[model samples]
Target: MTVPTAVLLARDDVTIRRFAERDADVRRWTELDRGGAYLALEAPELLAADVRAFFGPLASA
Candidate 1:
């Protein structure tokens, strides 16, 4: 079985993840929703901040 990279990266468990401010409005933003999956969520700003904090090193590198 071969799973696509997009599938591997797409967030599955929402329990530990959320959407970013600039991306929260995206319909099925994740690869998991590729087939016309749409969704909306609140508090996207926090998610964005958290993402920055977590991946800041990569950007600087």
Candidate 2:
């Protein structure tokens, strides 16, 4: 699924950012290592860290 970043940026009511799983494939396998689409299930702590990083500043606002 492609995000319309240009269209989204043209809107004034939203803030957006993109996170790319560069090593992940459609089936969620990592190209260079053992990882799957079930990241939250496989790596809860890592997922939590990324989520916190994304929203942490907003919480402080």
Which candidate achieves the best TM-score against the true structure?
A: 2
Tens digit per residue, CA lDDT, model 1, 1-61? 1211111122333422343323343222233322121222433444455455555655575
| TM-score quality measure for candidate 2 | 0.41
lDDT of each: 0.34, 0.37
TM-score of 1: 0.31
- Give the Å shift of residue 4 in candidate 2: 14
Best by lDDT: 2
Worst 10 residues of 2 by lDDT: 3-12
Instruction: State the number of backbone clashes in model 1.
Output: 0
lDDT of 2 by residue, 23-58 (tens): 222222112132345655666665565556555655
Clash-forming residue pairs, model 2: none
